[model samples]
Target: MVRNPLRAFFMMLGIAIGIASLTAMSTIGESTRQETMRQFKNMVGNYDLINIEPGASATRGMPSLTTVEPTLKFGDSDAIVEQVSGVKQVADVQNAFDLNVKYRDRTTAAAVYGITANWLEMHSYFIDFGSVLTDEDVASVARVAVIGPDIQNDLFEREDPIGKQIRIGGVPFLVKGVLVTRGAGPGGSSLDGIVFIPVTTASKRLFNRDYLTTITVELIEPLNPEPVLQEITAVLRERHGIIPPGEDDFGFVNPRAAAEQVAEVDSALTRILTGISVIATIIGGTVIMSLMLIAVSERRREIGVRRAMGATREDIMHQFLIEAAAASLVGGVVGTLLGVGGGVIAVLQQSMPPLIVWKSIGLAVVLSIIVGLIFGLQPAWKAANTDPIEALRS
Candidate 1:
């Protein structure tokens, strides 16, 4: 290796490339998985929460302002709470999109939501100022509203939003509170660009419809949501007069199921990338074997001289094997440095949360050494089997 620097460098380069790819891809994969979960949590609250909507195609992960059909009613929400066991809280939701929301001279089109008093708590939203809606407000159909941070910024700007009146589709509503900033949801939708009103007020005053867009349910802690979900389905099916094998008008948006789906997709992608890296490592091993064979053929006379000078077959084999392992070990160290640098740059460029995987780095170094030993076997055998008398004559 010292006499032929170029050959040694080429042998190390292949192994380095393979190890670098494996380490870098594994680091990126873990970061992506965590990011996916964060996005899901932002869109839907927790694993024990489920949203039931009035259409068969409403198995969405995020809340929507529009519905395909209007079959869900306020009574459905009441029935779920009364009949379904392990249910902690339930809220009926009504939504209207692209409504003109105005605060004095400023105006913008935004989604308006009408929710029960427990809705904010169910969705894990905290009020930055003032207070949430009361049951009395919903029962009496009061003309009051809660605005999000985006709405506050768009309409009120520097002025105070509380106590000011905003008009939603030509109806005046007094602002009661402002929600804390939630940033963005799935698909970059603004979670704070909306208004919240009492469900009764929305049904009787704003939209004038008895149908609800969704029924949000929160299950009790330490309880399995599957049983509660089945019970809720059975109750809805009976109420809607649907028999077995008959198509139901309602669908569930289960947060747990959605989260599992995201996890599965991430896992599959990681497996495929890892497989590709393994293939590259194998190809690198093949290159090492081919080059070592050529070296053995060129240095047959050296083997004969060593043998005549009292070197045994085992000694000859060990020398070649050690040389191969040394090259791979050096390559592994270099690859690890390059891989870590690449991963850090990727996180900085994408502005993603940083996550370091030390286990993967350790595994990559081990894999390189194993590849070196396995591929060096054939060449080592050829060098060890050389005949001293025949080689000296040649």
Candidate 2:
């Protein structure tokens, strides 16, 4: 039979497009999964921190009256830490209400955290300059502050901010240190856009409130967080003089639990994308089969001439099958190259590093061969069974 290079080239193009699309989709899906996991790890931190808030319980199984009231005081943090076991450290944080800060003349909206000296060790935070607030500052209610990277950049503008005084809520507080950048949280909270001051100073001078908004507790080891969490709950309940089996007005978060939830979401996303890739491959195979059938019908005279020239039925079938396979193989190779190039372009455009999984490339090549064999069978058989005498007359 005569070989048609043009027909084979077009057939290969179709297969190549399908494979390339699948490869691009898979690479993006996998990268998204990895980035999400990285974000989750950063958001939860390395320790368990319980958030205490006010709530009401149902009376007689009916909804009771609920009021927005404060439930925890600034002093309760130390009380709980002293009473509870397995707690390595506790830091009470109180955000200033309307912290209008000013540096020389410029001003920006910022969150002011009243934290203890142990805040650094409790939350895996490090100082980029100078030193953190110490117990001496907290005890003496000293007017010293530590600012985040964003705050430092906005306030000082390339100047060494340490030892300089910044006015917070009309009160002058000396800059003691600058915190290393912590990037952004999952909720878009800017970790490096806030300011830190002594808890005692903030409570007395800034907000004048005895209640703390949140308390962060760190454990000696992350592996045994459940026991530490339980102990914290028990101590808080006892401190508040709650009766047996009563619900406490607090919430606890475990990093391990958050990581597990993220894994479930990642798995679901993978399955959905994989299904879409499979559908695309099936459509490509159908197109190849249709094109092969048309080729067989158009080459009827060529088939007859080969048979008349002593070419066996098996030989005729083998020749056509090989042509179909060759078309698909060529298409698969081109598709793989295009897919890799597209993946690299996407990463560079998005400011991400490019990654190519060799296993995915191998899988695409194998699938292309299987698609050719399955779709080319009927067309090859039809050509092999053609009548030589009828073909010669035509």
The backbone clash count of each candidate, in order, is 0, 0
CA displacement after TM-score superposition, residue 315 of candidate 2 (Å): 5.4
Error of 1 at 109 (Å): 3.6
lDDT per residue as tens, model 1, 103-209? 88999988899999999888888899988999999999999999999899999999998899999999999999999987766555777888999999999999999
lDDT of 2 by residue, 1-394 (tens): 2367777777887788878876776676566556566665565455354344444431111122344455677767878678877777788888854467788997766789888888766667789879998999999999999888988888899899999989998889999899888876654466677788998898898879787766777777657666676777677777777777776665554555656666677768766876776677667777778888888888889888999999989998998788777778778888888887887788567655566768888998888888777778888898898787887777
Each prediction's Cα RMSD? 2.6, 4.9
Q: TM-scores, in order shown?
A: 0.91, 0.81
Q: lDDT (0-100) at residue 8 of candidate 1? A: 85
Q: How many residue pairs in model 1 have overlapping backbones?
A: 0
What TM-score would candidate 1 get against the native? 0.91
Task: Please name the candidate that would achieve the greatest lDDT relative to the true structure.
Answer: 1
The stretch of ten residues in a row with the least summed lDDT in candidate 2 is 56-65
